[model samples]
Target: MFHIKRAYEAYIDGFQEITMIIPKSNKHTVHSYFELIYEDNRKTKLPIVTRIEFERFIKYTVFTPEDLSLENKYEIEDEFGVRTDLQVGGVIRSNDFDEKYAYDGEDLGASYSNHSTQFKLWAPTASKVKLRIYQSHGDEEKFTEKLMERDGKGTWKVIIDQNCDGLVYNYLVCVNLIWREAVDPYAKAVTLNGKNGVVIDLSKGSHVSKVNSPLQSKYTDCIIYEASIRDFTSHPLSGVHKKGSFEGFHEKGTTYNELSTGLDYLCQLGVTHIELLPFFDFEGIEENNPFQSYNWGYNPLNFNAPEGSYSLKPEEPMTRITELKKLISVYHEHGLRIIMDVVYNHVYELQTSNFEKIVPGYYFRQDERGLPSNGTGVGNDFASERLMARRFILQSLKYWTEEYDIDGFRFDLMGILDTDTMNQIVTELTILKPEMIIFGEGWDLNTSLSPSSRKATINQSHQLSKIGFFNDKFRDGIKGSTFSVQEIGFIQGKLNHDYLSDLLLGSVGINNQVSLFQEPYQSINYVESHDNHTMWDRLKLSNGKDSEELLKKRHILGTSIALFSFGVPFIHSGQEFFRTKEGIENSYNSGDTVNSIDWARAERESSYINIVKEFIAIRKRFNCLRFSLKEEIVRHIKSVKVHQNIIGYRISGIEEIDRVKEIMVLFHNGLKDTTIDLGNEDNWEYVWDGTKHYVEKGIKAECNKLPIPLLSTVVLVKY
Candidate 1:
């Protein structure tokens, strides 16, 4: 049994340090022989010593006694000077040992041919740390165990020789006469529902190198499609063997491969990018499920490793990696980019987390009362201001980009990170991959924080000029039809329409001026994204009716306006097919029932799909529709006519001298059909009308007045 000789907190430069002592023993003793093992499978024997003194500061540490107490029992002294017992008595083992810090002069960190592995844990408060290696095949067998040696710092490391790669292991750490087992914070791999760590073959698969990727070309034209892996595949129409798995996306005959959901769908829809939801290792918290109590994958467990549930065969470690490469290749071949929606804001609150176990105070912010900050409302918020924490985030980004050939990243909650960190990341990422795209949810949840608390604060507004933001104002104005009084006057066909003109020219209203017009693609315009209510749901709320025909008309009008607006237009998945979430606004926690895109609706709602397809074609055909440059290319004829229920505007543009471009747009928001005058034009021609009428040259006589159906918009081109 280990006993603490002396225990007291010593403050150094606004940090606390904990020291511990353990008595040396003869047999099964603390000071006996031991070795250290690292990821490269290099080992070094521990030097025999009488006593070990472990000293560490709070900032850079990665281990906590509370996490280690899973196997061993321990005690903590409160502010009142009362000691409380903490439980411990499990096993702890390391999967990777940093050989560079070992006393042995060999570069053991670079070796990985043998089964031997090394583990390193930071336990500043532990009196002693021990390595427990269990027999691989035996039910209950004991093997050679050793007490970890402490260095100048409080790092505890041990090297052990194992029979094979799939052996179970744990760490036995002692704190205040209580011993417990703790899982390694840095374990690269773990067994499914098992206590021991599994050895992962990092080099077994073909790693995609960043140099070979063509991501540079497609990064600039990203139109991300955020989707869940399971929902995309589990649908009955998906038709793939590896359903709901990584391989399912690459499987032939699948919805994703049939050009129905993957590259084919994106290419046909003319979107340039696909941004997937969180794909990292996450816990599927069942209680939050909408249908059968399932998690939405927000509880991230590991940053570097992929989720096991998404893999077709978790034991075959390379399956997910290999399949992911195929998916990327398919998208790249079709001239489309892939972006990942990353969550570096906070991690799942697990006992074995790096934030909870090692350097807890350094990884997260603390309140005035010295409590963990919960800005994210998910138990804790990551302190991205910390250097080590920042490095970890950067490393994860680099690994995904360099290994998976991802074109860009869509940060989930970017405001959680400080401005300096974001700027540094942008600088480094741009230098590494010049065309890499970066954007995020710029709003910070914490209102109490300085500079970022205010809505569209001066500092935050300036940040938008540097990086792209989700243009919510533009979405609301176009979809909701509720803009400032100035905008209303313009849309109402009023004279001297400068305010409406500014909005029509792509102003998000936050800046009080037209900044987006300077670079149109910077404003990602959308009627609905994953966060907001679907366009149909919003319309239902406003209209208080569920008439399918009226909804279809509204959808057509919304799409036409969005595509014609001067910004990069984004359509949510299944919007073309008139997909609806049954009026559920916030379905982030909903299961497959609420989140799945109904492909059957596509066949039934063919008319809506056709309208969307036509609008997409029109947007692609005319560059001026989506043009952002501050140039008055289009000329307004200044001719307006108002019938009983219809309003019309006659606009024209000049291509060159002798070539005149003209179009007459009419909006009929009534129930009955009505005719409107086009202000005395002899050469006017009917080009497109929503009433299933397609116009051609010399088909109709010249008429200034045209009849339009109720609740429909008409566009007529004139020569």
Candidate 2:
């Protein structure tokens, strides 16, 4: 009976062979041979069969079964009236199979030595492990040397006296009288993408020993700039050599300048953070070539390693790290914080991954039917609930913060992570860096994962306390071009009942207001980001007009509203010059053809840039505009009224006399001329208007009723 059970289980893949134990109590004769039948009606019987020893149980390895053929599918039946069906499937076999090759050893405390080297790897299943080191001068098999033996937990370590810097190495473990090869899990530097494990000397190449400079501040106050490294610098306008590489970020006359171009722009635009797209090592799924072309960097192969393609020199990994450090240093120098986009949701599904080669079932989430679930739109979604999976994510984040000097992280699709694990990580990260800006795409894409209780809402949705969310409501209301005039009228200072006010005042019609106040600073407010069309593009598509002046005014008004609104404001890069992607909203996988910002537009539309600059300066000048919601300083001045096309709102802080501090914003969307009644205010004076001609001093005197030209927005100060 045990032999039959083992043979039945052996049908599955990954089970190379099976051993069965038959009990002596079973009343069966040796002459009654085992008969097996497939689903196709094919039958076979064992010609030589014998009974086991007269013990309670017997164990022996069954003869290796024929490799499963596509035509083989059937049932099994024996003379003892035992019968079962054969189904093609796979399973992970553990007890008899030893997949591990290394062991966990004593804690080798942090080291800074140049000549000495330490190695560590985790292999819980191995009984004995040997470290094989190859001499640098010859074939690996010719000059082999055993360095050290593994410890009790299956970890092996060795520190050689010779300069073993660039040596190729592998672990050979003896399991059940068989020896197989395994790669060292903890190798800092690997060769041939881990096909042939090689040791690297950290002192060589561009590895820098000094601690990286601190970021400007925590990322809660940042305005993100999401860009692909390759697409950002490969164009002729980029003007850099290590084009699209990490070193290119330091190239004097390229997009790095444009990256910093928005520093003063953001400082004036009133933003505190800059969330960069994924900078981790990833393959280009766009062009299919792993070495070149544009990719969002989602297919992560190595968690600890940087993307080598982003380095000027592919042979040197240290150069990538050094260049990234310098980029972070420069952002820090300019008082701009950096938040990296992290994708630990899944890994590339190629042949060279640890998850694919060993213990595949342990890494990914399985469906109810016992198949891997591909919910993340990638090949598979990681099961964060598993102990090993949880440790991998946490360790990766810690390595980035401690090694790369990252200010914070924006998790991509954080909802896939288990609730308990997400909370644990939030707590750990907060403790590590109290002000770390942690946020994620809280909504899950899979219907099975997204329960009614788990769906994301702006302020009330997240399970983690310190982590903020990207408020999609604010994004939709202000810039979701599909909204009708009625909707716009409800939000843009019309329909005085204030529907937009509800969202603005921290209640976005969701549950659990308690979490809303826990950290409202966690919310990122913006009309546009890298994922969506530029606000300008949306406005043009909605209004059906190409009026440059009107476009400039609308741009200023949208940016001004975002800067002065409640939560931290984020501006997509190139928005200051009225950048347009020509109305392509979902350009995620598109090539450089559709996504690149036209730098020439800035020169042609200098007036638009000046308007944006002035609006930013205005936002910077007034504390009332940038005040936190806790201040409770906003008072609705009901004296101002709204007409068919003109709308006005008054905001006064604690101070009233300072011209630079007090602000009254009046906006006109009407096509025809209309007079706006200021309700007899005594000290109102014209401060700034969207029109380029308004910058001149005497222009205010020549206009009728502040002369708000068609589709113009104006800002005034109480003298």
Candidate 3:
């Protein structure tokens, strides 16, 4: 009969008000009288402030001199004794509410001890809270229900005298007078399919030793190779027993036709870090029949728990943790670090998400009309600016870094988040691991967050200098637009020397031009990643009339630019062998058929793969390519006045950071051969001429002129 539109503290100090709507169907003659019933049944009469008649309902405002606690639910009664539960409306999204109920205690989730376990849940607006403990995660009936006492900052707490290890639990929160069950938002471990939270003994596999990763002096020195645990080993020819699982991903001695296929292949390929797609607990796959469906794990269901489908024993909570740890350990031992692709920009769905269930309106952003913001395109942008929301993200990242020994985090749709959150993430994660790599998709998206300048998009990259952004400019400038296959890039003969030169110089400002980054490492140079079509596939579409031989070289040219650019180089899992997705663009749920990494392609494209390896070696060998500061890049790197079809640069101070005195790079973007002027003294040598690479095997060129291979990247090193 009545809807409580708002019951919040007015901006004027020491004043409180309530707004309610009474439908015309409730033909009560006297609708002005009302009383606010507190939780203890104490009734306080409210004075009528204003009323406005509408077509179908009458809007009424009641004023109270006293400020009531929003944490304690109240009820409102009309003159006819029709009572309605006081519901949270626009107030929960206000700054006053966030400051009052923001919980800072680290014990928001179940904290286990040898003899006792304490559980805490942040449900400030709930009328009642109950803890449901189940013997098993999937049990329909709970073993027992216990009432929890309200703690400081609107959190509910309860202590169990016995150990809670292996026990499954969830909270039943009574909000808006309706009981709803939800998993703990801070759950570190979950049962199969993330149905319930598990009290995990974190010390079970804590004995895993530190991995012997390679020495990377700077973040730009990292050669990132992105892969998914499922796709990396899902191919039928992948020589491993545990297909598409954590154990299989790191399985040693895996090969096809006596060639390395899985982890071994990555090791030999010279990549420093392996960026895995979200391996955290996500939706879209049945844990019981994991092989029946496929997902890239972007739909985050649990922040701290590993994905169940990737574990061999999904039913065992500890199995996932230990197995994933072992996987990281294996890579670390092989001199490769790991970076997790985290999707904190949004949840899989807002309505069914634990954040909405616990604190309905606190976790996500809302538009002026009070609807969920869809900046993420999947509904609901995470409210990282909120204190409690930021706390949750910070804690989750720390847990992964400390517990799983995670080296870095790659944020998904980072633009939807606030700048403060991204800065804090980089600062804290760097403390835990100084050699950490942090970057994300900083695409400027339309979101409800005010002051567009505060978004962590590339537009605000100067504010977030420590974090890197995926260089869309590099992708589009070198390989064409990722979204369109018909558009050709500089490598495909759509040469724009000045534009391509900016990208080759790491997209940082040069020659008074506004650039994308303040520092060189802030640009993540790559043409292919997990999100778009492979470089081979795109070149095939854009240059449809070109031959396969020329297409392969064009693909190599783009990869070459990305690797040798003045930024962190990134490579997709199957980019080397002309890997195609059969024209599929968004393969988030494309199953194993189109997404799996075909090992056979490795054998066919071994030659191209070797060239990429040499490019990596050159990048690692030269410090000029991995300049940490903007001043170093601006001073050392100079654009060469080469032909219009070629992109060229000279690093003069190479003797300072490397054994070589200087180096010159030429990217020929035309279809015809050309001559590049070399010194007549015969002091330069061919470090890479498309056919061979490496300084030790460099051939001396005793001439003043050098022939540039068409659609090829050439490097000349001075000794």
Candidate 4:
């Protein structure tokens, strides 16, 4: 076969260049001439040859008539028909091109019915498009190819006019002279390992949980708990039968030593939402042997399909979809919302990705040197600002919420996406689920996108009011720098009043000093998550010289502050039970040995788990702690200086807060005990004496004269 990599018009009104690899076997004579052949059987002769070598490929520069157009699909013939076709490479990437061919129809993917199934794809630059349908997912030889007619406005479609349910298929789009085979980006169901798209009738009903998620009117009411499929159930003692699969996670009544584990344990923890790490069709872990490998699912392969490995029967495409919906129903049954961790920042393999294969240069952002941008520290940055790309993301988000009833979204590397796109996402998703919780990591990475304001980084928080961002300020303030293990914070023995103040106010700007966020609801207070070191491991690393007992106190104190602080609280899966990864900071690809949640530790540290549960209770009890607006916080909260190392904040009365009039939260960060006298004040009860709750049997004001414990947190209330 003759290899013609690409042909591009580098400069207008000049000769075009064709890049190819000519080995010694296919060496041409000096008199060898070239001609262009169109699909319509027209021909044009070429008289010039220019050669430049690159690695193994050679660039042959030649000229055709200025009047001749290269926009049509054609082939390069040596004389008449013994030739190769050149792929188009010089399609300009710009907003103008996207607008010209953007398809606004909702029927982009396979629309299935009992009688007819219509398939549509959006590929504007393609010369021809074909559909390849396989009778079975694994049968490589048994398939049929059908041509697709270009229906106006960049969409190619074909109506089977017969039932195609359960049949596997892929698109063979002949764009730029190369016939690229790719699964439909809009495919709702896919075959094992996501090799091909499966046609299924979504109109039919499937099994789901009967119970619904609790009403969460305010966004601040969310208490997010992050976990992964394998990490949650892969442990040998996890008491799950289908370990590391969706069925395993769905199985309830599981426990170790009678203490709840797996799905049951999540409900017992009292978190409002469970944010699962990417469970979509990712590019890691063998579906046949999921236990042999471990991946956090950050490497996205297909944007809209659920991962097959998590299903009980990955070989069957419908099984994956059915099981995933059942898992979501379980979360709903427990009054917990499910948030899917979506990775739209980059793809797993740029060159071989479905987006690149369907339309090479349209889905990615390129730099001035004509190379892909690597802002995500990955190979390429997904250009979400583009019209078509943005539409795809919005469509995908709608599919998950409407199809699976997912209650929220935790965007990964959200900074790589555009601000306008993020704003549109919340507007669209909330329309389906009004109480949807949308949050993401907003770190400003060094991506190639220009005019930084357009990117959805934290710096552009003002433009995004309804969306929430992971408050790194709160994270570093409580657990110290995630990068510098030895660095200390307020709860880590070192105190920065400014950092404490910023975090306590949910990173909302205070006293004319604009902070990381404009509203408290926009700040997601979290000290530990899937990324970086768990708070337990960080404590051990930072205070390694200290005894294990003291380290536990530090961990509890940091977690307590994050829980009670003003924004939505987030917890790692096994954080309450002192989850440790053997000090592995970045465990994205580390095997199950380094990533699995140790239920054995959950049994050992159940006391700390109780403390976390109580903290979540206290946060949910007080409306002042979960204020959504900046005005509510500015009007009701004020800083109090009681002692040298003790940081205290007071919350005045709010009508929404019932049974509690005024609240005072005190944190003692010193090395020694100190007396925090109440000045003989009456009715100043201790609701929480550092570690214990006293809502029924109040600890009187006399308890205030008692010396405060070193590195402890307490709540005082006057009812």
In lDDT terms, which candidate is top?
Answer: 3
Better of 2 and 4 by lDDT: 4
lDDT digits (tens) for residues 1-719 of candidate 3 = 12334332121112276777777766563466678887899998876687788787777778765776766667888767777777666566778877888987878899999788899998887878999999777886747899999988989999999977898998998876567899988887899999999988888878766676776878888889999999999899989789989999999898999789898899899999999999999999999789998889889899989999999999899999999999999889999999999999999999899999887788999888779999889988999999889989999999999888888889999999999989998888889888889999999888888899889999999999899999998898888888766677888888766667777787887755678898888999989887877887788778879999889889888888998888889999888777888878788888898999988888878888888888888887777777777788788888876788888798887775787777888888778887866555567887887554444656875446788878888888887
lDDT of 2 by residue, 101-172 (tens): 211222321122456655544443333456677554235455565645444433455665555566666666
CA lDDT of each prediction against the hidden true structure = 0.54, 0.54, 0.84, 0.80
- Name the best candidate (by TM-score): 3
Clashes of 1: 39
TM-score of each: 0.69, 0.71, 0.95, 0.90
- In TM-score terms, candidate 4 sits at 0.90
Better of 2 and 3 by lDDT: 3
Considering TM-score, which of the candidate structures 3 and 4 is the better prediction for this target?
Answer: 3
Model 1: weakest 10-residue lDDT segment is 89-98
Off by over 4 Å in 2: 1-6, 10-118, 123-220, 253-272, 285-292, 350-352, 447-462, 481-497, 503-519, 536-541, 545-552, 582-585, 627-653, 656-675, 684-687, 692-719
Q: Return model 1's CA RMSD, one decimal.
A: 11.0
Question: How well is each residue in 1-719 modelled by candidate 4, as lDDT tens digits?
Answer: 12444322222122244433344334552324577666787878775477665564444555666433334566676643356665555433655466567787889989998999999998877778899999787887899999998887788999998888887999998765568899998898888788898898765436554457788998888889889998899889899888999999878899989789998888888889989999999888788878777888998988888897888788877778878888888789778889999998899989888888887788998888879998988899999988889999999999899888989999999999999999999999999989998989898987878899988987888998888999887888788899887677787777766557667877877645568888888988888998899988888888888888788888888888878788788888888878899988899989888898899899988888888888888888777777788888888888766787877688886645756677888888887777777675667677677754434447665645746778888887877
Cα lDDT tens digits, model 1, 218-280, are 222344566666666656665556666666655543453323553344566666667777776
Q: In the order shown, what is each candidate's alpha-carbon RMSD? A: 11.0, 9.8, 2.9, 4.3
The TM-score ranking, best first, is 3, 4, 2, 1
